[model samples]
Target: MQEKFVINIGRQIGSGGRTVGELIARRLGVKLYDKELINLAAEESGLSPEIFEKADEKESKGLFPTLMGYLRAPFAGDDGGCTNVLSSEALFQIQSDVIRSVAARESCIFVGRCADYILREHPRAVSVFITADDACRIRRIRNRSGCTEEQARATMARIDAKRAAYYNYFSSRTWGVASTYHLCLNSSVLGEEGSADLILEFAARKLNTKF
Candidate 1:
């Protein structure tokens, strides 16, 4: 067997999660995969990249409430006699196949796309979730994307909503709910390098690998 560890990251947007994931991958000398998974999925599934991008990290249902997300199932029945909506099995299959292909090829760090859930069966796997305070996340998004604070906040809301629904729909676990991951780190507290160092140290202890 190839003796290597796989680190899968599920993170909130603007949490400096991607930067931390990249840093950990570099520290561990492992390949980092994020948006590349989209390309890989597209190629594997013969689906256009645009289609996958639209569905990526989003629930099949557009029904998540705009308020505090109490999701009243008001329109739950007889919408074209459809009973099962929000099904993501097709997307899940694509992600699962792509993740397995990557894992078979080499050990690496995979960020988002429910990679932890996709690769749940792998033996040498560590799953992490990263998040930050609303204010911190909004600031980071505004700075990175050059959006106004309101725009940043709105974008965060939409993206996080989609991610939550998609993750919950597929994984049978709540997103960022603390119980779904082996490590849950607040990037606001640790910052980028500090969070990276914490993950590196944890990995070192678990895998007996040197930084």
Candidate 2:
């Protein structure tokens, strides 16, 4: 029998979280959404994809001026100068709408953007967090990005800080904490394929259905 469910994955940078998501999606014959979500949100909102890309999983920096402009204008000027600015809140709402719509349509894997919290009400949704030790993450980052160890560490710190800030600001729960997820796995300990397999096993058990 085929089972329908949604999987939300929250991952640390260089943890191979996206790779695990892709593997699970393929095994379950479901769509995997990560960067694709930005395009989907852009299409649905009639906004440029670049706008969504810029705001993806990052807090709105230097947006206060634009937000204030929109609040003040409320409508176009006599010269047809549009004062509509896409705030971080607006972008998040649009993406959340897209995420809900897609989840309602079918079972799929959502790689990030706080999908777990967004779909908290879904009965069949399972949320997982993927992380790795600092050394392993640094190594993976260096290899994939062709950076020195110091550069990899810096990159990881910067990206993780952005992700943490985004998640903490938008969601009620704290980011990367074990209590916030149904299951948290260390990709470095298990390896990418092994991590995917474990997630499948856990899902099978939790959902009480075979994959």
Candidate 3:
């Protein structure tokens, strides 16, 4: 398709959502932004990338308290006030700007970090939610993370909770809800490649273009 469009994927932990996103981007010949977004946001905000990495997809303890801290001083005071004190909300805002900038410039696939919500008003954006059965997710997580089944399950719960909390805190929509996304797919049923193919077809149909 000559007309550029953005794909925003929201996925549960260990559901092969990233794999599907990478495959779709490869098939469409566009850049995929996941961890790359942190670098872009860090560059734009002039804050240490490590901070963004640590705060990625995590909700702040309390927005009011964090804003009060920011108001108290321009930077977050820690270790004699040398570090930048950007709250989770500040980091999200910076990343949202980067997402908007990228979408404005070209076609790309954005995985998580609420890209769907950030680009809600974009004329040619496709939002997808990728999920899988818990058993499937646990097995996938165990294989990828080299952890036991119990550890995998724990990891999944922890990460998904953080993502849900972050998404709910920042956006008006709820995370992993099918209605919040234009399309929802079960990655385990279709597998990564199949899911990517489906997304490409869906995107083409949504944009009324041939892929």
Candidate 4:
């Protein structure tokens, strides 16, 4: 109980992974690291946050956009040089450092951005994966995004592909696989509240903590 522990969550798009992570953090009275990580990584790297956000959960696609973005950065050199070249890989390393630094500092829940793999060697790291069936995921996405069924499906595919590509590129383990995580929950079956409760219980048991 002296040392702090961290919960790292990986979820499929529309699986309510973010919601579950928030719930766990609230119940544990700890901070949740999600989009907030982008801000931290931006500060850590001394680059614009927009570049990190744009590269979030994606692989390097091309050079032109990144190059153009560099010229637009306020800190960019007057010579229009790429002193701080930004790419998906570069952004990932920055985020990974932020993840490790924050995890070491406090007990928190990290949703996505490959936090599980980033903190793989942490003594008290708990990793989880949330997944749902196609119908369930599509329904959640439609409800949250107010998009048509086709649009929801498309969004799911796009986001899932990007997340998988990002995780697989940076992690030795594949994303969403049961063996890769300490616990894998079907959010569709458990629902958001139930999923959070189950994960909390799993973490308590895994870490031998009295939560």
Query: Model 1 — which ten-residue stretch has the worst lDDT?
Result: 63-72
**Per-residue error at 73 for model 1, in Å?**
35
How do all the candidates rank in terms of lDDT, highest first? 2, 3, 4, 1
Regions more than 4 Å wrong, model 3: 63-81
What tens-digit string does per-residue lDDT give for candidate 2 at 1-211? 5556999999999999999999999999999999999999989876678878878899656532354443345454545465456788878999999999999989999998999999999988899999999998898898898999999989998999999888988896799999999999999898989999999999888888888
lDDT on C-alpha atoms for all candidate structures: 0.80, 0.88, 0.88, 0.85
- Candidate 4's C-alpha runs over 4 A off are 61-76, 79-84
As a whole number from 0 to 100, the lDDT of residue 180 in candidate 2 is 96
Q: Give one clash count per candidate, in the order shown.
A: 0, 0, 1, 0
Clashing residue pairs found in predicted model 1: none
Deviation of model 1 at 8, angstroms: 0.9
Screening candidate 4 with a backbone cut-off below 3 angstroms (N, C-alpha, C), the clashing residue pairs are none
Candidate 2's TM-score: 0.91
Of 1 and 4, the candidate ahead on lDDT is 4
